[model samples]
Target chain A: MKARVYVTLKPSVFDPQGKTITDALQSIGYAGVEDVRQGKYFELELATTTPEATRSMAADIADKLLANPVIESYRVEVV
Target chain B: MRFGIVVFPGSNCDHDAYHAAKHVLGQEAELLWHKDRDLKGSDCIILPGGFAHGDYLRTGAIARFSPIMQSVKEFAAAGGPVLGICNGFQVLLEAGFLPGAMLRNRSVRFQCEHVFVRVEQTDTPFTLACTRGQVLKIPIAHGEGNYFAAPGVIEQLERERRVIFRYVNASAEAVESANPNGSIAAIGGICNEERNVVALMPHPERACELALGSSDGLVIFESVIQAIRSGRCAATLRHAQGRPEPSRGASPPAAALVQ
Candidate 1:
């Protein structure tokens, strides 16, 4: 089984990198860009074959290790 | 006092901490490898600055799982005095020893310079030697040093006097321009409610010598020694005496924001 995890800063947290990217995009004539928030994506291969089990395991990993609960939130997708 | 400086694989400031403790402060000091489980009966434990675990994933993220951290956690739970500086501060936050998180500097660049930090609370073990509102000059070097937390947490920290340091100007005013990394409320350091664990973003060890352009950092070390000598660190001493451990609980939530 394979899993994908998306980690993003919470809405209340400041995103400096995202802000800079937004500025660069606007400078390049893409003035329509309003807000940009940077995040992390992780793809993992699990030895488990059960999709249900994989999803739970990935979510646990994301909560405990891949994401800091204080500043980040994560979503898990298993396929 | 005996100081134990934990040296993670990528730690670059371990020697600086050791030198500050052993030479500058004239105290017994030892470097404890990250893999070691024993604290060697240290009176104080220091997690110095460096790119621990190569700062992969996130700063201090991977390093928090090192074998020694378990021991560090236990030591702290027993009310031992633990000081985390710079990258060590990030580790403490990740490990849940402290509240909040670090973000990239608002300028989006690595910063390395001496800045003024005003002493906010001197009742804690780490600042007992300094007067409240005294300013110390210390150097900070990091790309991700901005500190953030929820608003409620900030209010609680303020109500309990957990905030210990704030970036400030030469005259000890916490002006906007003086904040180097955009830390909430210009916080440079904070301690748990028990005052046993402290985390600070500045490198006091690097500023302990006059030849290093500042000796102001010595006050912090002196404060710790004074705390120990005066038996103010009753919890840690009680643990050292093999008394029954006190009940432990999670630190209260804290928050801060600079207007």
Candidate 2:
């Protein structure tokens, strides 16, 4: 199973990289850009056999190592 | 004073902080690895500046979960003094031990230069030796040093006098123009509500030596030492020895505002 995880700074944390990208895009003639926030995507090839097990393990990764629960949030999808 | 500089992966300034505490101030300082849970009997814990984890996920985002941070947070909760410089400041925000957050520099490039900062408060151990409104010339090197917090939180910080440092010009009188990274209200550093933890973007240790052109940063380290020599830091030390936090009023709720 493949687990794709998306990580973003929690709404409470500031996203400086996102702000810089937004400004750059605007300067490059991108229009109608109201706001921008950056996030990360991770594709993991799970060693677990069962899809259920993969999903559970992915949560563990997000909670323990993949993302900081305090300042960031993460979502995991199995395929 | 017993000091411990946290060494996260890719931390280049751990040695700088160690030297500032040991060589500059003539105190005992040690390096604590990211994976080590032991703080090793330190009274003041410093989170040094550097591209920790290469700032891979985000500035300080990846390093927030390092094993050493757990102890660092515990140390701060115990009222021990904690100083976070540059990337270390970002780590403190990521760890939620301090308020506010860092965003990319308004210039969107790595900014490395000496800037002036005005001391606004001297109540905390970090700035106890500083006279109010004194100016400091220190170097700031970071691509994401812009500080952002909501307007309400900003007001609260101001009201509590937690906003301890503001970027200024060489003259030290002018504001805004000295804003290197567009930090809100020209803020260069701030402390927590209790004022026990401080995080700043400038590198004070880098300017401690006479050859560095300015010894403005030396006073900050000296302030820490003075704080230790006095009984003011004893409460922090007692907390580190596992004494329960005095049941004073609950700590104010932390507010977050990211621009």
Candidate 3:
């Protein structure tokens, strides 16, 4: 089974990297890009398992390793 | 007093911390390897600055699970004093020794420079020798040094006087310009509710010697040493104070009293 995890800074927290990218895009004539929020994506290869188990395991891994709950929130997708 | 410096693989400031604790402060200090399982009966533990475990997912995330960290966790749980500096501070947060988290500096770049930090609370094991509002010159070197916590958590920390240090200007006002990393409340350091474990973004170990621009860092090392010598830290404090909590909020700073 394959799964993906997406981790992003909590909305309440500032993302200066995303803001800088937004500035660079605007400078390069991509003004239509009003804003950019940066995040991390992780692909995991797991042993074949039930869908429920896979999701639970992925969430557990994301919570413990892939993402920091303090400053980041994560989404798990079974791909 | 024995000071234990935990040396993670990428820890570059381990020697600096040992020098500050041993030769400078005249206290016994030793380097504890990350793979080791024992602290050798150290009275205080130091998590020095550096990119531990390469700071891959997040600073201190990987290092938090190391073998030696387990021992440190137990040590801290027993009311032992632990001080984390810079990356060490990040690890302490990840390990749950301290609350909150670090964010990329607001400037979006790694910064290394000397800044003034005001001692906000002096009741902790790390700041007992410092007078509240006294400014210390310390160098901070890190990309993700901005300290962040939920608004409610920030309020609780403030109310408890757990905010041990705050970035400040030469005049001792915590203005925005003086903040190098945009830390919340201009926080440079903080202690746990127990007031035994403390973590700070600035490198106090680097400023212990006069040749290194300032000896302000000595006050922190001295604070802990004196605390241990006078049996004023952690376990002793827990019983002597005879209160459910330890905070000097109602009492004015020693300097303020003189003024």
Candidate 4:
């Protein structure tokens, strides 16, 4: 099974990269964009036989390694 | 006292730390490889700056799982003194030894320059040699050096006076403009409740030599050495001094103090 982990900075934390992207977008006449927040995505290929097990393992990885709980939150999607 | 400088695969500043400890401070120092489980009975352990484990997945995230970090964690749990500088600071945070995380600089660009940091608390083993409110001119080089923590954690650190250093101006004012990386509270460094574990964004080891433009960073190294030589745990030195009065007299520049 395969899993995808989405990690994002907490809403309250400032995202400098996102802000710079927003500025570049505005400069390029993409005025409809109000703001941008950056994040990370990780795809893991698991050898588990069941989707349930893959999801659980993915969540564990996200919590323990993929995301820093202090500044980031993560979601796991098993596919 | 003996110092151990942990050298991870990508660690570039391990030699600088070793040189600072062994040559500059005239103390015994060794480079401990990341794979080594033993710390060789070091009095203090340092995690020097570099893109450990190539900073993959996140800075310090992968390096935190190295074989030696297990020993480092155990050492810290036993109240051993640990100083994490720059990338080492990130590793400490990632390994759950410290209370915060690093974010990219506010400018979203790599910044390498000399900045002033004021000693906020003088009780830690890392800052015992520094006077309270003394500003040290140190060089910081990083792209992801902005420090962040939960508001409650920040409050607790403030209330307990665990904050060791704050970005400040030449006049020692910690204003927003003086903050180089947009860290919360302008925090440049902090210590744990026991005050043995410290994490900072600046490169104190690099600034230890006079040729490095400033020797301000030596005070921190000297402070650790002094604490170890006093035959007391760094945390207890404050109580040993009768409730920890701040050092008096105007703070001298690092050049003058070192000479």
Candidate 5:
């Protein structure tokens, strides 16, 4: 199975890279931008045998590899 | 006193911390690799400062899952003394062993320079060797050193006296301007409520020798030694009574007398 994981900093946390990008976009004449929050997306190909197993396995990957529980939250989508 | 320093793939200050333990305190210290499961019977463990795993994805985001971290977490849970400096501090936060998180500097820059820190509370093994309000000069070099927690969390930390150090300018024998990173309320370091684990942005081991331009960091290690010996004694006593190794979630009463 193939899966995609999206990891983002919690809403209450600050995102400097996102802010910088937002500023650059504004300077380049892009308007109507309110805020930007940076995040990481991971594409994973796994052969976990079963779909039910894939969900548990994906959650494990999220906790162990894809995200840091303290600041970043992650979601996984199976393909 | 046996001490161990964990070496992650990109860690830069592991040797500095090991040398501080060996040269300053004249004690033998070991370096444990990130993939190693054994801590090797060390009384204390340290996660040194550096851009571990390149601080990718997040400051210490990847390193938190290293094999050695599981052992480190077990060590801390077993009432062993643990200290994390700078990037190590970030790893501790990512590991959920410490409260709060590290964000980019308020100015959005990777700050690297000498900074002053005031000892806010000494009820922990890390700061018990220093007098309350004492100031020390140490260097900080990190992109994500600013400490962040919700206002309610900050108030709880204050009420519990968990704040360990705050940035200050103690160079002129006075607390001057703030340091390289603009941390929340100028915080440079903090200890868990149990006070056995400490995480700080400043590199104390880097400042332990005069050739390093300061020896202020020596006392920090000394405090750990004192706490370990005392804790071992308590652990032994508690073991005799068949009690679960006294909780590591609060400061030992004797810690208050350390200062």
Candidate 6:
């Protein structure tokens, strides 16, 4: 089984890397982009075959290690 | 007083901290390896800065589970004083000894320069040697030193006088340009609620000698030594001890910008 974890800075938190990307986009003549935010993606190999179990375990892993709850939020999906 | 410097595998500043404590300050110091479960009866602990676990996941995420951290946690729980500098500060946050998280620098650049930090609180174990509102010019080298916390928590830290240091200009005002990493409140260092554990972004150990640019950082090491040797309680009870009171009325301008 494979699980995916997505980590992103909360809306209230500032994302400097994302803003730089936005600036790069503007320099390349792109427009109409309201905002850009950067985040991390993690794909995990799990031993569990159950989707429910994998999702719960991935969420727990994300909470404990993949993301810092203070400034980042995380979502998990089992595939 | 015996100072224990925890040396994780990637910790580069452990020797600097050991030298500051031993050669410079004439205090007993030892380096505790990452896998060591014992604190070796150290009166105080210093977490030295480096790319712990190669900073794979997040800065301090992997180092938090190092074998030595359990002992460090117990030591802090027993009211032992601990100072975390730079990457050490990241470790303390991951270990849950300090509040807030380190975000990427707002400029998205690795900043390595001398910056001024105004001492906001002078009564904690780490700042006892510093006078209130005194600015110390120190060098900061990091990309993820921008400290962030929830708005309510930031308010509480300010109210409790836990903000020990704030980035500031020469005039001791925390202006936007003075902020090296866009830390909320321009916070350069902070103490735990009990005041025993402190996490600072600047490298104090590197500044202990005259050749290192500024010796202002020596005061922090001196304060820790004095605190442990004087038989004073490291943890301030309810934070009601005699703290210098100007911070309540003289909140820094950058702090207001975040709110």
Q: Per-residue CA lDDT of candidate 5, range A1-79, in tens?
A: 8777889989977787788888988888888787889898988788887777777788898888677665679888877
Task: Please give, for residues B107-126, the per-residue lDDT of candidate 5 as tens digits.
Answer: 68888788888898887878
5 against 6, candidate with superior TM-score:
6
TM-score of chain A of 2: 0.90
Candidate 6: clashing pairs of residues: none
DockQ of each model against the real complex?
0.76, 0.27, 0.77, 0.87, 0.42, 0.81
CA shift at B200, candidate 3, in angstroms?
0.5
| Candidate 4: stretches off by over 4 Å | B234-259
Give candidate 2 regions above 4 Å deviation: A1-38, A44-79, B235-239, B242-259
- The model with the greater TM-score, 1 or 3, is 1
Model 2 DockQ reads 0.27
Pairs of residues clashing in candidate 3: none
Model 1 ranges off by over 4 Å: B238-259
As for candidate 5, its clashing pairs are: none
User: Mind giving the per-residue lDDT tens digits that candidate 2 earns over B190-249?
Assistant: 999778899899999898888877788989888887665564554655556663443222
Off by over 4 Å in 3: B234-259
User: In model 1, how large is the Cα lDDT of residue B7?
Assistant: 93
lDDT of each structure? Answer: 0.87, 0.83, 0.87, 0.88, 0.80, 0.86
Off by over 4 Å in 6: B233-259
Fnat of candidate 6 is 0.95
Q: What is the C-alpha lDDT profile of model 2 across A1-79, one tens digit per residue? A: 8998998887866666787678889999997786788887899988998989999999888886677664578998998
Docking class of 6: high
Off by over 4 Å in 5: A48-60, B171-179, B229-259
**Interface RMSD of candidate 2?**
3.8
Task: Report residue B106 deviation for candidate 5 (angstroms).
Answer: 2.5
Q: List the candidates ranked by DockQ, beginning with the highest.
A: 4, 6, 3, 1, 5, 2
User: Best to worst by lDDT, what's the order?
Assistant: 4, 1, 3, 6, 2, 5
- List, residue by residue over B41-138, the lDDT tens digit for candidate 4: 57789999999988888899999889999988877876678999999999999998889899999988899999999999998879999999999999
Q: What TM value does chain B of candidate 1 have?
A: 0.91
Which digits, one per residue and each the tens of the lDDT, describe model 6 over residues A1-79? 8999999989999899999999999888888766799999999999998999999889989988899999899988788
RMSD of each: 7.0, 7.8, 6.6, 7.2, 5.5, 9.0
